[model samples]
Target: MMDASVDFSKEMEALTKDLVGIRSVNGTAGEREVAEFILRWLRSFPYFTTHPERAFAQEIPGDGLGRENVFAYVHGTKEAGTGPRKTLVWHGHIDTVGTEDFGALEPWANDPDALLEKLLAEPDLPDAVREDLATGDWMPGRGACDMKSGDAVFLVLLTYLSEHTDAFSGTIVLSLNCVEENEHTGILHGLDVLDELKEREGLEYLFAINNDYICPLYDGDPHRYLYAGAVGKLLPCVYIHGCETHVGQCFEGFDASVAAAEVVRRINYNTALCDGYRGEYTLPPSVLKLADLKPAYNVQTAQEAWTYFNYFVHAASVADILAVLKGIVKDSMDEIAGRIDAEAEKYAKLAQQPVVPPNFQPEVMSYDELVAAVREKRAAAEAKETALDDELAAMAHKLRAKGRDLREISLAIVRELVRELHPTRPLAILFFAAPYCPANTLRQEVAGEKKLYDQLESLVSSFGEETGEQYKILQFFPSLSDSSYLKIDDTPESVATLYQNLPGGKTVSPVPTERIRSLSIPAVDFGCYGKDAHKWTERMYKPYTFGVLPKLILKAVAEFL
Candidate 1:
């Protein structure tokens, strides 16, 4: 199956140690360093030395840090005498989250052995962590588990496939992406690279294998698993507007803060909104951000506020997310209005004044409708030569250039639109925010795909029986990953809803919906097991990660190629 002389374990351990020691945290110059290091390592091989074009670092289009993704292509020795046969892809992100959580271990966090030694001596270590350390099987350090281990596995696999072309039937394209921890700029650009390569080289894409980190769903988890699909993420943002009034006139008007709390109360960790796939359910949506848009705090009631949520989806479309969110916003606003009306009548009766109910009719609309309504109203104002939309766009551009975050830019634009449109009081504007990842799965309906899936399941189970390495097969990975860029399970028409509804929709990284949809690359997540990914105690098991994972991944990929 492979060259008996080559030591896969030694190669993996050496590469992983070097990779983990390089502080390639997302949003730093270390991203470039990791890319350069990978390129050099790839070029060291005889195959790449003769074909240097197969190994190089590609710069992402708009990365301000000049970050790059390493690309290594290995063509199979088996040829069909046609143009180029089929190709399988191996994709992994090389970036890691920041090391701030390491605290006292920050100095040694990049050095796994030193960090493990220090951790073993610390009397204050947690009982569970100490137990894992005592076993002498886990390597603790930053990026050791979250995914540098996976990256090293892919690198070593690339070299192995290069040396033993007969191990796989077709060619292989292994890509180490950057920016997955933040904006996902690398893989987004990589979609273009694959498309161009396909056109120029006539290589048909078969599938992609993403080696993101895998972990026990809980402590003492005994079974390892692989997934056929990965989860998708969407951000449903809400901008709340209220009638501002002085604290003395509190009951006379509705404060946006009052409505914001009700929204969170109705939405926080509500499991009913979740979507399930192939016998598994996605984690329920939760608010990642919520804040009032008040500039300087005073006694005046908060008039404008905003919130955005982290929503994971399996089969839900952009339209489905918008509909569910719109329904929630409508109900939350209605309850708020009814409560304010009741309070206004009670306050009047208590003051011995004329009894009356507050009549601020609640209005709710989607971002698309709001923009259109604003356009309709602003046309009249622009008759006197004022371009409302242009003004907001320019302001957002300036703020973004100043390195302001997307959520802040989103809030500013929504606030400006609501303030100008003046859509009465007690209003809610619902919209989607940046960084929308679409969910995809193996296309069972596609010819021969179901067979491949079945073969993989059977092979993994038999392999476990043969080697005593246990694993359960999952239909989907339960987290977000760069594998999202591999394919589109949804239609192009359905994804346009996301493109239209994002704030400053034209400014964000554009997903070529039609182009990506055309390339239906089945994806899977198979990688090393570990725990506490971003914590100071992050670690991966060396026995399985180094000794067993590479062989298993090679076998699984051979089935596809």
Candidate 2:
């Protein structure tokens, strides 16, 4: 696929390094800077300058950081008897995760040349990392593997396509998105751009190629792989409120932390609660955040406690997941209820007086129930002035204006609700939070979907055979991506699970569920081969990722077109 005159390997290497040199950590100024640089690179070509409208930046609304998604499309002139042009979307995330993991090398993290030298000389380095450095087959730095290298692939391909537009008979759309490390804010907003573009240009969507990275599961894992679909993710947060009483009257009030701890104990790393599809099982849910809601330390047992877990969605529906979570909460409450009464009884026997044990009863409910309770309470109060929904929306907007991240805003809204409703203590309230990504997998039963996927599998196999490299088409990508926005298997109505309950869902990077499902483009992730992505020792395999993968990508897209 590479032209003899063009130094394809050198082009890839230079482009990758140039992208990595910029410290575009997610949510930083560097993120926007990198996007601007991409814009300049695209418009640098005479072709783009002539057709400036073809390449432009799409601002992601409500980011609060002013980040943008860079888009450039090239049209192929292959004679095809069709009403609308066939289009292929090639997308990559340009923003990288943070550099705090770099430790003392932080100052040079973005300077790959200096970081490489520092890593090679560092003592107590892992044997594998040291060996890879010695071989000089790896390019080490933050974001080098996770995806700036992949962005380089998209940039070069877009350039190649722009130059050779007449050789193929389809359109190619290159999307460089931001904020994949956190909320996937960039691609979520970019979904709007794609929908409008498809309608205005009358282009038929085919599929997307996500140029993320592929790392081994274990040492020396030799197979190169691609993903036909990606797993979904949801953050189910549990907030608990407890009765407050002085230390002298220990049995009079129970601590909310007890129930919170129980929730974590029952849910964290519990494989029985995991979701499975075909033979693929998602990693068990684990707590991403667990903390009390107190502003500061005090003598009184915590008034409220909060925790949230990372739940991967596979074959299970949202309702299926909520039922399991509700069951866990109920079981946790029952066990905690028993403990409270038993402990109170023990204390009474030890003290030996006319003592009255609190024997606090634990209560569990979903966020939806909490909202309903608040509404009922408002109706009883007969405030008659403000609608409950409108008031909550205003409050959420005020919080966003203060610059709190979506997670904090989410918790804050719940806290306000708790205060207004004054829910009974030893209480657990469960709800979804911002940045919910629904899980998606291709349904081969759909018309033409099977043929498209089979064609992709064959292309991967041929590439592997030609290069004498092993490749496997995995069921799930085993990582999070913006690809979730490409196609959705769930009904559009199913979106209410998050929007109706997640605090500030409308403002904090809401998933464009209907738009995504309507687009419904099949997606395949062919990533740059690398190891230890998001780790300090992250490295990309220069020979294959830079030299060979470009040809493979070109061949696959050309075959599809």
Model 1: residues >4 Å from true position, as ranges? Answer: 1-7, 345-354, 379-399, 443-448
Worst 10 residues of 2 by lDDT: 1-10
Local error of candidate 2 at residue 56 (angstroms): 1.5
Per-residue error for 385 in candidate 1, Å, reads 8.9
Those runs of model 2 whose alpha carbons end farther than 4 Å from true positions after fitting are 1-7, 62-65, 380-386
Q: Write the per-residue lDDT of candidate 2 for residues 1-561, one digit (tens) a residue.
A: 336335477787787888898899997988888999989998998779999999999887766678889999988876665688788999989899888988998988877778889998899788899898788788988888989888888888788878887667778888889888888888888888898889887788888998899878777789888888888888888888888777777667767787789899999999997788767899999899888766777788777888999988876767677778988988887787777777878877887866565666677777888889888888888867567778778888898898887888888888889898886657778888877877776656766777877888889888889889888887678889888879887665557766766877777646777788789987788999898888888988888888778888888767867
Q: Specify the highest-lDDT model's number.
A: 2
* Predicted structure 1: lDDT: 0.81
What is the lDDT, from 0 to 100, of the residue 370 in candidate 2?
Answer: 85
Question: Residues 1-561, candidate 1, lDDT per residue (tens digit)?
Answer: 554335577778778889999999999999989999999989999999999988978898766789998888887775454656688888999999998887887999999888989999988999999999889889888888879988898888888788888766677888889998877888888887888778876788877878788888876678888888778888888888998899997777778887887788777799988888766788888888888878897999998888888888888788887888888888888898898888888888888888677777878888888888888886867656567667767887888888888767777787778777886668898888777777877646666667767877898898788669778877677877888878777666667788667776656546666677787777888878788888888988888888778778777666666
My TM-score estimates for the predictions, one after another, are 0.94, 0.95
What is the clash tally of candidate 2? 1
Name the TM-score of candidate 1.
Answer: 0.94
Q: Would you list the C-alpha lDDT of every candidate in the order shown?
A: 0.81, 0.82
